[model samples]
Target: MHKQLLLIGLLLLVLTVQGQNLWREGEMQVRVYVENQAQADFLKRSNMIGEPAGAFIRCYLTPDELLHIRQQGIRYEVEVDDLNKMSASMGSRGVPNGYYTVAQLHAIADSLEQNFPDICKVVHLGFATGMNELKAIKISDNVHLNENEAGILFDGGIHGDELGGPENLIRFARDLCYGYNNDAQITNLINNREIWIYYCVNPYGRKYMTRYNANGVDLNRDFGYMWNGEGNSSGPFSQPESKIYRNLMLNNQFVIHCSYHSGTEYISYPWSYRAQSTPDAQHHLMLAQMYSQSSGYTNLPYGQGYNGMYAINGSTKDFGYGALGSISWTIELSVSKQPPAAQIVPIYLKNKAAMLKMVEMAGYGIQGVVRDSITNLPIPALVFVNDFMCVTNNPVVGDFHKFLPGGSYTVKVVAAGHQTRVYENVVVQDNQATTLDVVLPRDTGRYAWRVISTHIAGNNPHDEGNTMGALGPPDNIRYSLGKNGYAIIDMCDTLKPGNGPEIKVFENDQTPENYMVMAGATPDGPWILMGHGTGNQEFELEPSGLQQARYLKIKDSGTGQSQIPDAGFDLDAISYVYRPATDTSGIIEGFTYIDWNVLIEKAPGTEIYYRDQVVYSDENAYFRFQADTGSFAMDAIWEMYGYANCPVHLSPQQHLYLNIIMEWMEPVETIAANNSITLYPNPGRDKVAIKSLTNNPLLSLLLCNAQGAVVHRIMNPQMNVDGEILLNVSTLKPGLYIVVGIDETGKSASGKLLIQ
Candidate 1:
């Protein structure tokens, strides 16, 4: 009994000390709403907040600075006043209630190991400056040995106050181990991958409910890559907690990693210090999109430069990427710091599929061995695709994992004291891992080739404009009348015919169309026909014998058939496939992705025009679409679009464009309210009443069958004394019909009319 009391006293004293050191001298978290860019810039200049949530910037301020802000008449609200009190309050809620205390967390970890001895093992990851032991769990078929499989690390509670991370990770580990026999997905993931979940990376701050460690250092900002600010006492890795992970990462190989945090619900990838895009932007986006889509969370890819969020440096994800070759990402779990216990399971369930998907994706891409030709021993070599700069190989296993969006690439494998091996025409399929193992011979001469630059001909103005739909500049622009519109691309330098095809043309291949490719040394071409292609597919230039040229022209044959008027062949991008010099950045320099929400917010004149009439003046329409669409268990639009009511994906870019078009065209809410097309007794048994609440006279009302055939037509409908037009839907078959109303201004609104 005395020992228990002594232990309790020690815990109380520790908490007291941690609470005192939390804010240190002056610190308070505030959420300030800024009206314009100037106000945002003002907060930025002060260096208070790292990122912004739309117009609201979350700031950690001092008392003196808080006074200055109020004096400046800046509007602000306190998010957390006293860190100690918040921590204390969080502790009172107990394990899974709000957050678990250090003792409670340790107990939970111990329980997990005891409960699932077959698959789970708790690992103590050394200790922090506060003498608290950091821990993680290893779950796999054989956790005792280095398995010949991909490695995944799920880290949480990097920041002390971010309770959701650790909580969700604990629950996930439990589910994976508990449901192994019953759940097929869990069984597959555990059997295939070596998974590690570090429940809390920073235990010191977790005790105090602060963002920083015991030494007043933010562990996240203590990494080697792009680290800013003065190191606390112990220099870089001076913090014992960071040093442990750093050493572990250096020694082991982790192919994929996801770091969890709270504050905002987002998925941010590597290269956060600069505005430059990652080499594997496409792959990262595919995974990031899948993660958010799986969780039904907001999808934001890459970093602040593209996302409009604030720039964060020296983060765990960047360290894992820049220092190690792991494709690490940071997932902001929720908007709240420590979500209630009831919300924890729901949040985990939402993220469970995404977690499984990440593991599955890691198992994908190209996986193979790099070895010596004679010895047949593994050689730690750098495997690289010319297009993406940062993506490399896992040195420990001599295996390279490269996930490229469906295309062909020139793969180069290089190692110290060895001849570089070059594999030409390596084809990568989407969502599938391709294997290519190569043996490097002794050191030889370096192969060199100039980088080719692409430019469209200025003469074809209509053919090169980005605004004519083909999904901005990256996907290029659209062109119609197959024979009339042709785009000529200048390669900037003379091209020599290599082993395989030298040029690639992106086309809207949905319709049966053929494009004629002609090449010449100059723009005023004495041209030769390179080849012809059909369908909505990328056209690769297969040079015959030894053909070489600096200019390539893609012309529509007009022989291509299309039912839609003016819908000829649409060109996306034209690039020459050149053997690149040393793998470097700036190969394909352009934004490859754009989020739908960001488009709605930033695009000028972004009014939604419905069927060339009734422009939606409200922004809520976008929100409604984002939330309403998508399937319950699925994270992506692919599953969502599978429903009968959902849109179709002819092409990813065009599908999004068409969805936006449909969002504007379909009289969802804005049109139904403004244009006033109201149908009473919606699931009408016999007769349905229609009302037009607009000043414009109702010109015509048409009722169409499920196949869109005109079943009933009311010409020049007259309103009754009560301002409602009664329609006899009784004669219509007991099925679904489209109710379309035309106004005097030629504005048309459509809704569903059901007959039973």
Candidate 2:
């Protein structure tokens, strides 16, 4: 009894010192024995680190936290009293001797890109808190292009202390890059699929041999979907690392996403925040089982994360599966973090076959493209398989792939600006794929066309509905804004307020739930409250004092139990009150191309801007918009390549067509030498002059703002005998501008100008 008391007092003293330090040093790994769900919940609330074994759960806790656990009378055993010291004792400072360091990993990626330029390229994905470059490598037949292929992402090192994941990922990447044409299966997979490898996610944590980033946030718990502020996350996707991950997932349509870790040997998938299985739980299980079977580990297990491990919120696997519709999961490589140097190669060899199999399986299942029935162009659409939801087609290729067990299922395709289509009894085989190309007719209704891609909030994976439910016309299907959750809806066209209610909110169910309707000129809004209502109702913008709005933010009034289904307002759709243009609207249609002279390759992703409205060119390089009849400057920008600007004058009911040729811009020195054009008084406060050394007569002069918008135009400008044209710039803003002179022969010369 005396010894026990002394031990307790010593533990208290250590904890007190640690509490004062505030975890500036590191954390301690502990095994807390639990007898019931309540104990497990307590550990989970304390940010459990690894899966629970028979009678205890393992977690990394600061001394302060351990003291609190002891105060609660929870029996625990200290596995590693100082995780940082243990990590240091494992090998070196950055990583184990055999394991690749963060800098070495980046150098390897660079080497791969340099050696196999045709099959590999490195993509710089933002930076970490410690200014380490977060990078990924793309391996495919056409690595530089976004081809219509099944995309799969394999990432590791999210927890820097998990040394084996990065080692496995880097080895896999090297094998894939080196075995391109030498290996048959590898060559075939490379030719047919796009593989992404993000080797190290937390360089700072890896460098310091810690579990969290420099900011002490666990990146795995920083994702946005169903986020609940666990693992020291300030908010959903609040960290720069999480934001980079979010952007990467949102920009690409990945069919399968695997995040690598090391703490135990298991394959865990989806619904990490709750015990309920995902709607695609069967599919997830089938894949996990296949992966386990393929791996060299004879007793590797696979199951749902919540039950197999413990409940967690804002996990990468959950975000990937719930928000992006990817077959996402975590592959815990070893039973120990930072395994011995001799064990690194053996561990990687064990999971290598399984990783390759995953890449191969990515191409299996339902594969097809969604397109416009009238235009015969590809459409970016969301695909639903019966009760399962949230799969999407690649915006660039309009192609989608979903892996499912051998069975017949219902498939539904929904796209913005198009009618929804459904197919019953779509048959898919176990090992084979089925193609079901769909062409949807256009929907001409005045409704919110698309849900703002990234602004969805208050999403619960356990709910019956998804974000897509708030799209299109009211068809009974709806997304529940779970207790204060909000979704920003994008009206493809602006809503002009004239008389009665200009916007209508549709609540599918009969429940009289209350919600607030707000309007914004942009997606990220300082929202102006239009009005409030219950159930299906109409709102007028007159009270909000807004003339026009392109975005609507609908927030559920926080009421009812959040854990229940449809806890708050159920939103079916939002519609706009359409008032026909009273002889004031005109259409602007155009095609964007790289170069009209040489092979005219259509630039599909070009941004076309008119006034404050911006639209992207479709798959066919075609874009059309209706605008109020007036003189407006228009521009088309192909990012990193070049931009084209023009002055427009619209008459009522006029349908003007243009062909925007975006030529690749050469270096300024090259352009000046090639075009023989010079500008005098370049940084002038009042005026500047442009002269052509070749004596090329100028037909017109255009002054473009920094954003490539044409602000001023001069037709038939007079020039002196020296072939120089003088331009006045006193009225322009004090910024850099591009002065473009078009010769009579249509040859153009550009020079930079600055105004004070």
Candidate 3:
């Protein structure tokens, strides 16, 4: 009794000094580093507040503190790591011991496939950079997984060194397949859903015991979805781990792809697209809420990106929903799950139950493809869902992807700048799939600009309020043209502070005196500083007169023109001459993309006509007009009279092509008298053609169609030469058009010839 009181008094003293850092009912566990014995005692007491039996305290202590405890021989339950102890704890029968090596993992996956003939198969998703073999075990029972009610995909070992996730994942699979017939809940979960177990999404990382894959690319960050800012795994499937999993996940209709990572213990949902609320955020929140209730894990909405703890801006979850349309999440497996591994079985087991319940929870589905609308050619477009509540946003790319629950989603596309498009009401049905094919328009337009040089913000200078402001540009317009390739902004004129970022300008064709000039990054050159940070820290460059360029590149110069470069640079935004407004006021809504800098190779002659309709082109290489009929798209053989099959595609990236295929045109009617017909050059050279009376007056003409409709006409005076006439067939697309003519005698004659 006296000892108990002393211990209780000590705990109270600890509590008095250290605030209440206890695990409330269902609260997640994060390691705590107390300052003193009192604080440690308080933490020790609160660690058991709502913790059930068999739980332990794992302190992340300083070397000094560890020494103090060890030297004094203090009696307390705490530890750092016990690799062997963790490896020894086994699950149900048929469940092999956990391992830490890549070879061991492969062997285990292979054995599981062979042992469980009814429900699992080992598949080689892809090979690694070092030519190392990478594979996974797909555990299922329904021979072919035919029409299961739901799909639950579990991917682990994204952060390679985080071995806890792999262990839990293997255990879950073992429990599901092995425990199905034996355990009721397990049986039910397996029967209702095709729970896909994808252990070691980043096998190469796991093999090396590193956090990133062999490519030095973080596996969890490789998804091609939600790819702006710090989003996506180092460049889509660039890492072996992310590649195989991406291929696997995109092919399957998963309701929930609950991936695992260690270091922190939290069940976080989507919106990794950017650090803001997405259109499907409510759904994610609801899932988070459900997760909290189902798993009884404290939910923290802070930094979610591997970059930090805050729910990231562009992540797998972001692309999952924004790109593939799957409700995905990054479930941080705790480093707090102690050793003597058996102590964690319950945690993994409980999560298994929670995951099973989540599978049954409501989920929205999404499906899509990127293809050239005209030629039906598939081109990759960066895609994403824009949430109204965001400071910044970017697009997701690649083929099909997935996210959390679905609902009304707005898909915004940004590729070769062919008029950024948006698809609203991209509705997603629950427990089902929605297919969307994104058609990329051809590029051809005026004022169609690409990024030029990047320097300091133009607004950096002025009578503005900035004291220590030396990095940003001065004045409003100091855009000077240098013989070399930098659009030198004159900031010494009207400089100030509290401005925007550093920027620069250049023409796409100008060869930089130094491609490595101002653009110096950590790795190397060809760097260009765009926009970055807030108004106070970034460099801002003003637009020069007629900003005529396609690709101007710039990099951060240690010049007093912009923000302090952290790590590599402060490049945060890209500026081009795109209609910066959603609501555009124009004669034609079809926007144009042009490189005023790229000199035109062709000179304009008289109005070029196609099918007798005058087609116009601007100074730049772009043409625009509106049409009521005809399905427009990109890439096709434009058969006009004599241009020798000109291959035409859209610029600014093409939108809709209203091609007039005279041959495919539906037969209508014709007026032949003054509307009669005439043919140019009696028996012409390349094209033997005829014209409607709409062409000349001297020679009369007539025509008929399969529908008995007079299709053409021509007159006499409109002709010249050897008593015949020269037929202006240059504008006629290769096809048939009737020609009838009458003389002073009022008698009509008709002739027919095919034009190539």
Residue 460, model 2, lDDT: 53
TM-score: model 1 vs. ground truth: 0.54
Q: Write the per-residue lDDT of candidate 1 for residues 499-555, one digit (tens) a residue.
A: 445555556445556767778775445567778876444333344332467666666
Clashing pairs in 1: 293-635, 294-635, 509-535, 509-536
lDDT of 2: 0.76
Question: What are the C-alpha RMSDs, in order, of all predicted structures?
Answer: 28.8, 12.8, 21.5
Better of 1 and 2 by TM-score: 2
Estimate, for each residue in 1-756, the C-alpha lDDT of model 3 and write its tens digit: 699998887687556423421111122222333335564444332211111111223333334444455554444444334322322232221123344456666777777777776676676777764455767666555423222234567777766556667777777766666875897866655665566776776664455444444444444444544222121233333455554565465445465667776655665665532334444556566776666567745543322332222323334565455434456777766644323456456557657757766766622344455543322322334444544211101111123434435577776654433345678888876645666656665442111111111222211222211111112112221222211212211111111111232233222222222222222221112334434332223233332221122233333333332322221122222322222111112221221221123331332221223211235444542455532222112211222211111122223323554322211111111222233334433223354444434433344554433112354444443544434455555555554333545555433444333344
lDDT of each: 0.58, 0.76, 0.42
Query: Taking the tens digit of each residue's C-alpha lDDT, what string does model 2 give over 151-227?
Result: 99999989888888888988999999999999999999999999999888888778767778867788887776667
- Candidate 2 at 273: error in angstroms? 1.0
Model 3, poorest ten-residue lDDT window? 389-398
Residue 94 in model 3: lDDT? 13
Name model 2 segments beyond 4 Å from true: 1-26, 45-55, 84-92, 445-468, 486-504, 517-533, 537-554, 575-627, 630-756
Which order, best to worst by TM-score?
2, 1, 3
